[model samples]
Target: MSDALSEASDLSGDDSQDVMTPTELIAKLEEAWLNEKFSPELLKNKSEIVECVMEQLTHMEENLQRVRKGDVKASIHRMEIDRIRFVLSSYLRSRLQKIEKFFPHVLEKEKSRAEGDPSFLSPEEFAFAKEYMANTETYLKAVALRHMPPNLQTIDMLKAVPEPCLDSFVFLRVKERQENILVEPETDEQREYVVDLEEGSQHLMRYRTIAPLVASGAVQLI
Candidate 1:
């Protein structure tokens, strides 16, 4: 586990007094989200992390209010609180982008046989997405059915339609060298030598083939 994760793991809901500060918790969550091998357990614990952050934010707000009333020492804490809020917002934005990419599917109402890998998302997250999609579909259908043209009225909802994720070809830069890549090249000329990649090299290859390397941080997606 990375240092941030290790620190996060050490914290528990019951041990409120000894738990990491809100800033540290946010940092840990951010790092975990960046990792390709994000744990389902982390998703499960998201509520607890959010609760902690909210409590801290509430306290910060109280302090800021008091400072506005004449307390000067609380000014420093206000700056730190604002910084943490910015980081927390950024962290949420990154997760939102991923959720947006999948949109209604995250809500899961219509059910797509070709659902993308949920390995990166938690069960709770998937459930919440489905709920959001269901509500949106309900609202749009009610509104659009009246406003939309005759032919377009029967249009399939984006969530109900199963669209394939086009991630087959990917561009990436090597962050670390790999002495051997198990994947084989089909051509006869490439069969004689094993695949070797050096650091700082950039290439476009099959996303599935390089997924493990990306997860391991050996390569970064471009």
Candidate 2:
């Protein structure tokens, strides 16, 4: 049950006390997957959950290697491994796409982070973003900027790629009741209002309005 958590200290790079049974670990990965898929911007990195899942996969795979091919138990183990691999690869690919699309913004956010604040990116993601940024700048300068006047040559990537549409509509389910959340108007003619998020209720609303709630685990993006 705790096999997945065996590498917690090694993967997390800290003596983390957090522990989860295999079921809990899988649930966390699924939850994280949903949140990442729905959010316009990259959410906080779920490195802990990812690390544990990876550990589980590795342990299961090693056991499978000891079994003969096509055994019943081996078949089931391989199926589970493939399923986990699918989710893990999808989750990482989604993040990498965002990093490529919004590298400037991602790096800026990491740069401005205060000391002791939890990182929005994992170490690998941060390095990827940095490399992506460098490559982009080089490409731009070589193909376009070199021909432009000096004054016009400088490119601000932050302005070039717009930030994620935080105010975009999103569908979510309330996990815990939240009171008096402000909802901005859809049009100038309409007035802003507030509403309570009843537990277990699902609604379509602006992401910005519930952004904090999503980060706090008060709601689940459908």
Candidate 3:
């Protein structure tokens, strides 16, 4: 009886060492999620947010290994993992939708302005519009950075979008040209051709030059 009791005590000790507490697991998961969402500078410096996510995944894998080795309680670990995964996935999906919705209006405005006659806008006025568009892009990017997780799935999706598709704003250079206009007389006696010279033309002059408005947290897709 004494030997059996000693064996049972040893087994219990082993189990205790192997499993992580629920509180500890929850804390670690939350830390990983927050770091991924709120740290854009870190993500940029690192070059790939997916790498950071992989590191977190590796840590989780280690934890799983411990459970498999009978060091932790499988039921407890599974529960914690499931909870964290659900929260992260739901948050990311919602945030991506928000980002998509926010960019379209800004893009449309920039497109309209680019297509409009630049002669109507002074240099100062154009500059202000450009600055406003830039600021909107920056704001959107920052918001995205705060909500997205640096994960393989997200990164892959971002990479798939064409660069041009991502850039919704464009600037056009307008140039002045001379054209001839013909005037017809009501009486069939004579017809007159007159050349009307104007500083601005009805047609918009645009060059092939394209500028991409990249936002801070905007991920570049292929």
Reference-based TM-score, model 2: 0.91
At residue 130, candidate 1 shows an lDDT of: 64
User: Whole-model lDDT for model 2 versus the true structure?
Assistant: 0.87
Select the stronger candidate by lDDT from 2 and 3. 2
Clashes of each: 4, 0, 7
lDDT, model 2, position 111 = 94
Arrange candidates by lDDT, descending: 2, 1, 3
Q: For model 1, give the 10-residue run with minimal summed lDDT.
A: 36-45
lDDT of each: 0.58, 0.87, 0.38
- Model 3 lDDT tens row, 1-222: 776555444322232343333344344334434433432211112112223333444566676876645554766766666776675554343333333433343234435664553332234333544565567556755767447665621332223322223222222221233345343344688775554435332221111111110122121211
Candidate 3: pairs in clash: 18-71, 18-72, 19-71, 19-72, 158-221, 159-221, 159-222
**Prediction 1 global C-alpha lDDT:** 0.58
Task: Sort all candidates by TM-score, best to worst.
Answer: 2, 1, 3
Model 2 lDDT, residue 215, Cα: 95
* Cα lDDT tens digits for candidate 1, 1-222: 487667655454555555574457766555434432222111212445556676677766875775554456677777777877775666555555556555554444325425663344445556656666667667877987658887766645564555435345666678899877655565877753457778999877666666667656677666
The C-alpha stretches of model 2 lying farther than 4 A from their native spots are 1-14
Candidates 1 and 2 compared: the better one by lDDT is 2
TM-score of each: 0.49, 0.91, 0.25
